[model samples]
Target: MNTRKRQLAMTALGVATLAITAVGTQGAPPAPPWFTWTTVVNNGDFMPTDSCVPTAPSTPPCRTFNSYNQPSVNANQVVVIRARSRGGQGGQAVHGVYTRDMAAAGPVVRILDRSTLVPQPNNLDSTFIEPPSFPRIDIGMDTVATRGNHQPVWRYFLDDVTETRAGTTGVYTNPFGDLIAGASKLGAVPDFSFFEVPEAPGTPFDVFPGAPAVTDGATIAFKGNYPVNGVGKTGVYYRDLENAPIPLSADNLEPAGGSNPVVLIANSLDTFIPGTRTIFGSTAPPSAANRQMVFAGFDNEDKPTLGGIYLAPLNGTTQPPLRTLVAIGGQVPGENSKARFNRLGEGVSFDGRFVAFWGAWGTEKKTLVLQCRTEGNADRVAFCNQQHPNGFITTVPVNQGIFVHDLGTRQTQVVAKTPADYDDFVYWNFSGRTPGTGEGDDDGELARWRSASFVAVSGLVDGTLTDATFHAAFKARTGILMSGTYAEPVDGIYLREGPGKASLLTLVETDMDGSLIDPEAVDDLGAALPVTEMGIERDGFRGNSLVINASMGTEETGWAGIYLTEVPE
Candidate 1:
């Protein structure tokens, strides 16, 4: 046993300080044979009638699956997802992109849906109106990049009958073969132009926001924006699908020494923001591996206290200057030394050499309120008391920390924090909008809070950097149950192993006990349905496996699923 007595026997069988001694111990907590769990697809199951399902209420296609997003895994355990169904046949909404292998239990393949087929120099008969709510996988193969929202397929004429312009959205791949018949098309956003950006050319990338990191040599890494005369620039690119150059038409563009895209960092270009002379006014959305890349920047994209986390190097020749790992005034390691870092998190969890991020320090807040009849509807509790004359709606709390860092020993460590080990890493709710109207509604907001952590990190590909064998896994919530004060929060999915050596084992929480979530699933008071919500994404942990998305009983014996476990060595 050893890693601090197997993290104190996994903190006495799954931490949360053993929820009041596991409320009279009866289930969950004794699973340490080496921890197994699996169940990669759930929410009424059924799908696969040849993928994407669809066909409405019945007939050949079937349907079922419901929802899921946040799954990636691939050190060969495969698993890549982004699902949504139930509504099919006519109420549309089938959405797809799937994969499953978990060492071959078979079934769940499908990659790309909405009836698949938008790969042509089109005329608006597109397919794929969705597939980018996280769908990546390639940490050493099963290649699966994604970013697809269809419909425009690039074509512009205007004076000669043939006009289509709406930036078709792109980035797709299947590279290592047979992942749903070798998927395809990997770059679009009107296929680069305004001279293709790279050293600085600017203008044609109407936006490609998230979902696009894939390396293990298939190289994809993305985040583009482009506006130019109306401001908005943003960067961080990369293409190299094993060498680029063949995209010419099916409206996929790139061809002329492979249409640019290898920039790595943009916004004003001098890049800066490490020790700060202030430069990158924006970046985030990148986390590749082996070909290296990790992002998160922002030296003032309208109020940012410096900015941090970098590391770039796609290795395509000249272009090598970003390497800082954590920086926004630094300090904040285990805290107090004047606790620095004023905010850093924009999703990071690289694996090339451990990066896992989330940082925030001081400005310590805590307001909360929230109560428009528990979350509106009487026209949002009378527009939340006509915009707060006090029916309730507040929110402040967000002091975070969840670090890892170690770019070959630059060292950083601390994997959880906020009021010294959990109290509020931000979490509010009640955004039953409809009150004033969307988008920050004149600041008298109705409620919205998030920063509930979310991390990943794994290590030891070849070990050494003082190899104690990393490992992270996150998604925290904790902060309540003061014995007699009674707030009782909990929420979980934690792992942490060799960062200051063990003590956060949990692996699933929020009233856990539905037979530790599936030992036959009970709940009509035959108890055992607990677990309410857990999720984890920043490419949901890989290599030694982690992959979550859960919700357990009651919307009528509820269940929602996607789970995989394995971390014990």
Candidate 2:
């Protein structure tokens, strides 16, 4: 198994032990509450279907499917992508994208529905096409996207199963669950799209599943496998959500032997689409702003060069100037001799000026920095030093931590580092496990703030880490929502403002008393709030509003639901 997979396995094992006895040893005053909880869409609710009325169209009635996956929000509305059963017809489950105000009266309106979209062959190639329905939507399959300028709008890219013939069934499917060809697709190009989301039922757009389009006058920074000489080619493409899509990274665009662009996203919360709002702060204004996008790409062959992150304007022809932000190998400027970003981290500032991600450095590199314990091995001299004898052991101040790059300054700074002392270990919850959902699996993604000043990262960080310096640096920051792990006395969600203090907000599940206990209300940091299984996944921010998916019962008897917790400014 790869390093990340191994760490997750270890995390799962740690969780097993903690579930038996999650009791806080010492007591402290309750920290102030930072967020107010609200339920956006739960599994039990019936989503509206066949709601739109196209000027000239007749689509089938909508179907309902449980399970809410993606949650995105803007100043106006919160949108979620939900799947519906095909009623057992056979092919795949259909999906719909809906928006709401958190308190809309009737059934939430679904903007895009499977019955409304029909896959057609990409005119350029007879075989290549888009996924015909929502059952084919897979965000974890490297299909990441963003709205044009992070505005609430239509989707720019999406994927689904391919049709058999130009309009038939029986297309080839892959392990990733995407249809490859239209009965006769040639080459390895996967079924994908770069079109707009259909505005009304029966008004089909060419692209596959994508984030909402750039309705708010934003640009689109999306990734897809477009056809090159009839063969599938992967690259980062930019569009203003107006004209055609432009390739930022593609074959022949990079120097000889260079690899394709592998863009980083804020998190694995949804398909790699830009949501309506940018989480990190940006100086770039709305006017003429959708012209550029930031991404990571490698132009060097042979050495696997950790690659360099690049930015390009949407106006450029051929390939824009490939500005290298930070590269791992080669004589590249800003190259970190000790570490390279394997898979780029997520969350870019609005202006495309700043980017935040986790990095791999020395032998101490980790997919989840929370795994780097600091207690007995507080110095990290044991495992960390063993991993990088020449790097962190001798030179680097901190081995692996979160870092941010300023496109304007061309500089990278460590936002937070693994504690050098065991007493200062950061805590994250690993108890929110969902078998097929890939929930607890994504333990430590970078949670960035809209101001770009502070970031809320996951892992098992407890209340003890709070100190004078921690508070001063993080006090002004919000959006730190992490799962409570076995490392703590309880397994619940914890909220903190800045780094001064953390409050045990609620448990993954209610306690034995059958009540969702509030630790703050009880004035006890380790108060045993009652609840049953309620582990949360994809807990993140849409601007300052937080969205998460939680399962109410164990996998056998529980159901998953989507929630919205508004952060108080």
Candidate 3:
């Protein structure tokens, strides 16, 4: 919605764009611009309404709190927010749809269709996740079993939400219907089912199946599949939404291990190429590339870990990967490299050529968005600078200036350097990484990016570091990608560097209600929005790129859900 300009205009794409603002005319009040808001899903009812042009002193913003988790829509334009009623609920709950301008009114909202995405049945747990389809959601839950090689299995449900939250796009639905009611067709391994675990004795296993229950209002998702190199996998896992999983096409479907990978994306959606190859050598077609339609898990040998950014091909993927960029890959944390999770943060170049992985381990140890160059070399394995921790050489802050790596020349230049860390003059400071589309970001033709920043952690929460999303080329305009501390609401926003790299973020100011990260702010990076999970959705979620955070927990209960936000362009 390029409604940036004040003049009302309609593009060829039927997307209505009009800036709304309120102002007072002495004793006389004039309406601003005519606008329409559709209450898609919420606690409200289906009642199309209208409102005169808002007459406030600033721009008018509308909020649609998540009523469903992994809210998905179909080509029929049906938007469904996945959800589950109280604990004792059964089968799929309400699934709402709507037309345009359903919320022209204030409170009451309307629905295009008011039917559950799927009819109640044998407790088919639909794990919601976004595929490569635009504005369309896909089910990460599995419908049938195939050769998944152990990657946290997932099947396409067309639309809905999953459990796991935060940066993890893969998630499982609560066990519904009859306990032990499912087919183990593929030889019967540890696969998900709708049968709710029994609470008493061994009746059926308490609560639902799978990991511990996610926290309320926390967005989470599953991380890796089976395993990678004998390491547990990680990906964006989030809860907290009324829906299931909302695939974050930017972070590269990866779970937490504390660090950035060495991959880049050319699309803002999941894309995958089987680890296996075809007898023909060229590999298989896109459809056959998945090998397993549902992601059950990955090879246990390659247990997934955080960003250990290395390069490996699917056992049977395409001959030459359509794309290659940094992604989570490591037997464990630190990847035995200088980059530790504490200072991990990065950016990828277009065309999957170069990667900017940053991290700062020790004191004299500053942040470093290590310039990882991957010039279409699939065999190229990313090796971190050993001098990282003990203070080898590279010492850039998460906000270091003029940081750009030119692949053509294989050169790393830090154009801008500050006296020292922002906190203390004796130390140097820096940062980088914008939440924009990692796709098509060929270093040759870079577009948008973010500025990673760190706040001086103190007291109990020693390392209270945060990442801010800024524009590429290190510009400080407005909007920054930063998380809020439990103390403050609306954490932070995408920052657009000014003429001199000065920041002008939106959340800090527009947060009229005090705090509560604005759900709308997640869409700053073009159609790419910050999601509960991490990863890239190059092909409708079939291929995800992100890191899994195993140490993550929820706001109230134990660890749950994943967290992600848009990077400013």
- Whose TM-score is greatest here? 2
**Each candidate: how many clashes?**
6, 54, 227
Winning model by lDDT: 1
TM-score of each: 0.35, 0.46, 0.29
Candidate 3, residues 411-434, lDDT tens digits: the string is 332322222211211111111111
lDDT of 2: 0.31
Name the weakest run of 10 consecutive residues (lDDT summed) in model 1.
Answer: 1-10
lDDT of 1 by residue, 132-204 (tens): 4577887778888877766665456544666546544566776735221112222223433412455544345
Q: Which 10 residues in a row give candidate 3 its minimum summed lDDT?
A: 280-289
Candidate order by lDDT, decreasing, is 1, 2, 3
Clashes of 2: 54
Ordered list by TM-score, greatest first: 2, 1, 3
Tens-digit lDDT string for candidate 2 (153-269): 112232465433222121221222222221111112222222311111121122212221121232334433333335323344333322222233332211111112222221112
- How well does candidate 1 score on lDDT at residue 71? 86
What lDDT is reached at residue 78 by model 1?
79
